[model samples]
Target chain A: MNADAVPLLEARGMTMRFGGVTAVNNVDFVLGEVELRCLIGPNGAGKSTFFKMLTGQLTPTAGTVRFRGEDITGAYPHQVARRGVGIKTQVPNVFDGLTVRENVFVAAARLHQARTARRIADETIEHVGLTRIAGRMVGQLAHGQRQWVEIAAVLAQEPDLLLLDEPAAGMNKEEVARTSELIREINKTKALIVVEHDMQFIRMIAKTVTVFNQGSILIEDDVHTVLSNQSVRDVYLGRQAA
Target chain B: MAGAIASGWASFAAMLLAGLVLMFGLPHVFDLFGLLQMTVFVAMAVLALSQGFIWGYGGIMSFGQSAFFGLGGYTYAVAVMNLGDSTGAVALAIALPAAFAALLGYFMFYGRISDAYVGVVTLTVTVILFNVFNSTAGDWYTIGNAPLGGFNGMPSVPPLNIPGHPDEPLDPGQLWYAAMGSLILVYVLLRGVLASRFGRVVVAIRENETRAMLLGYDPRLYKLLTFTLGGGIAGLAGCLFTNWGSFISPTAFSLAQSAQIIIFVLVGGLGTLLGPILGAVAIQYMVTLIGAQQKVDGNLIVGVVLIGFVLLVPQGVVPVVRNVLQRLFVRTPRGGTAPVASEARP
Candidate 1:
């Protein structure tokens, strides 16, 4: 058996519904250790719903989520987090009134001792290229900076599988490139499940892509293969089929 | 090291200086009766601090600190009347309220009660206690050789004696020193707690529970512990309140008491310990002044002040004043983000 023989994460028969609307329909997904996988989909395509299920934000209408070999179905977000699963939500969920260093410090403090957390906070802030503005209040930072601060906080968690939702949601071209580089550097050691909408940004970092459509995964393959598929263009790229 | 001494440490040092000045200086400035009255003000300031700690820092919308205060007063009165000693009674006072708070907090936090509902529910619980205590007037409602005199209250409640020595009751001057000492101790204790890792995490939960939960901290447990501590502090103040007049009454749990605690925090400033102390003493002094003159009703004036503060200075006095002073004194580059101390050291 290989060192990465067991999947790092596994979700089986994941489903979600709101009233009569089936937001996500029985989707199964898996990822290996030390791998980065991108999830791409159009708006309302249920990728967000699936991501929420994976992160324990939503208790699926029907499904089981497992980390390594443990059953973590319908676990609370905090419980999932303690099991070495960390997530960066679409919005920058941070302590807005606190300094950037403090925000990272709190996250780092969760899994480490005081001195260690402090060292990690400073390191993470530097890692995310926010060292210059580390003392500034997070609310006072620009949108892109807040996102990076959130990413730094997530990194401080030292999670086995880091799931990021729309990490480049509002970034400019320069910021997007920087984020992709950050993601690549991070992916060298950790596994990642990134839900993204930006295909151009995806090309910079994604080796394997999982394109989702109509509440299920349309295709899971190498990024180049998925990008060239004709049906993927029609469904996700919104191009007219020949 | 100077950078490590952030706003939190600066405020703590200022409070220590202020406490020392008040401890030595106030007795000389006031008559015997004035010293006794000042003791009452000190006790009430402690009450205000309790509410301030919970509602401001805990982010718990508790409108029932008066319930804990009243319970403390009544518990101290009953236990002291029976045992003829205040030591066990005083301990009971703090423990009872903390226990009650843990029970209430368990239900509220565990039940996942909404914040708005928490405020409403706590207010309703206080009102219920007021009614229940108001009706326990008959001789039949006695507890272990102590009377629960209902609305009339157990009058002439025994004053607190030196711990374990029932005969050695504190005289007016000594009581004033004791009460003032307690206030200062609580202030310092809370400041020390805030500077600790646990306190920082509590503030983090107050900032954003969802974020805190995501970071592997249980917000409910934190909220419960904070609410319990607030209850215990209010109870301690209640014991002092009972000793002030040598009386304990249902009126301690009155709606007026509930509102006044909020008013104190609102007037002085929320999220700061000194603000409540200042707010309580100043407001109580103003009320006494208004009481001395029959020209205007004190309640009406206080009510008007509450409305005025809410509309005019929503951030309250201390914060607004601190911000103004910071701007005037601290020189930062114009239009640049104001530099803040990076992280507070414990």
Candidate 2:
């Protein structure tokens, strides 16, 4: 990545305190355009908290988040979304009562005219390989398919940046492989930050990895470098192995 | 997709046709008293639709819907007496309650009140209104010439009249036409709204508020707007209700009335356009029949039926009927490909 080129997202001195506990401490993070990055951490490692701040789900106690050079710190989720940021939380967020296509249409209709919403929904549904069950209610879908529907809904927003939390958390190997392919295909046009505990899943999609621990970044480097780092293994991978 | 849309419109058209037949044909067969009773049921159906939209479609679960209903009746009674006319009174009856609901909803939703608290606040408002109106028994409580009758209730409220001729009130038969016509119009209008882009956003918010927010739609605005619309519809029903009985009472704001309105929605089926209307009309009709016997307590009978419905037909009549109909009509061919198998879990 070019140092002089303005990154797609830049966070400076990000901090979040919940009561007396500091959930996320001061941290600086940056992402380049169309970058594929994975964030890994333990349960309370603050990766989720940091992601929430980045996506405007939570207003940080202190920090500045800029996207394409515009300060968006403390903006609401909808406001951040309007600025071309799509977020998929750890839980599946698609409307269960609505059909698979309708879920995507709801997301797309916000940014497109009603006449074009159907077309956009169709394209996104197809992209996620859910075309066959597009007419089925999302609630009736299996867990993995429900997750895919959520991803399709997010993709329908056509955001320049996508934030996905635990996208492949409950998937089998084949489904996880398919998710990796989908993320890579999406990365051709948009930048992505995927938070996952599955190391194999991350290894397949991550070009660069950022490891979070104890509310702060433990390491930021190439996937191989981060995986091989002694400190990262001792603090994170070692615990996982145990 | 085209087939689904077409079928939806077809069902709507069929419902309108049935309504037209009942509106025109009922007066021919029924006596004046029967016609009046039917008209009252029609008005109640509109009330149920209002609650259905708010609770069923919007996921609001308001328990104080009768507050708006009673307000509409009281506003109409007071307006008709003071203005010596029904035209402006009718408009005020609908608009006042809607405006009130907007104010209340803004505070409830924008102020970030929880859903459970919203139900409590609304029910309390209704109880308060009931007490306030019940106490307005003195002569000084009069709004112009319309005396607030206190516990005795106001009788002989001015019936809806032609725009220019207040003296020539609509007869019971004519009022029935107006009542039935309004029901049909409200149903069609609501259907149109629920099918619109705004309606989709409202339903999405109802399903998942956080997801809708992430989709760039403000859930608060959509919920507030839906609540206001529901209030306006309930107000219209109340206006019609007052006309049907030629009276208004503080009982309109009673907790029993509010509970009955919720029962109407629940018995009809949530989120079904026709279900609430059917639920209200059927339950009211049953109550009327049992009340005439004077042997069984009407409230007791209604309570029993409601309990039975809740325990047995939990999804309500309309959805159950729809499921049966779908099974009969849309049978898949034997050995046809099953719905694409969902991915196996780890």
Q: Pick the candidate with the highest TM-score.
A: 1
| Model 1 alpha-carbon miss at residue A52, Å | 1.8
Lowest lDDT sum, 10 consecutive residues, model 1 chain B, at B337-346
Model 1 agreement with the true structure over B148-267: per-residue lDDT tens digits: 998999898888899999999988788888789989988888877776667778777877788888887888899999999999999999999999898988999999999999999999
Position B61, candidate 1: lDDT: 86
Which regions of candidate 1 deviate over 4 angstroms? A1-4, A239-242, B1-7, B332-346
Give candidate 2 misplaced runs (Cα > 4 Å): A1-6, B332-346
DockQ score of the complex predicted as candidate 2: 0.51
User: TM-score of chain A for each candidate?
Assistant: 0.96, 0.98
Q: Candidate 2: what lDDT? A: 0.88
Q: What is the lDDT of residue B53 in candidate 2?
A: 88
Q: Put down candidate 2 lDDT per residue, A1-242, tens digits, no spaces.
A: 78998899999999999999999999899999999889998889998899889888899999999999999999988889999899888988878777787789889999788779989998888888998888777888899999998999899988999999999978999999999999999999999999999999988999899999999999999999999999999988998998
Highest-DockQ candidate: 2
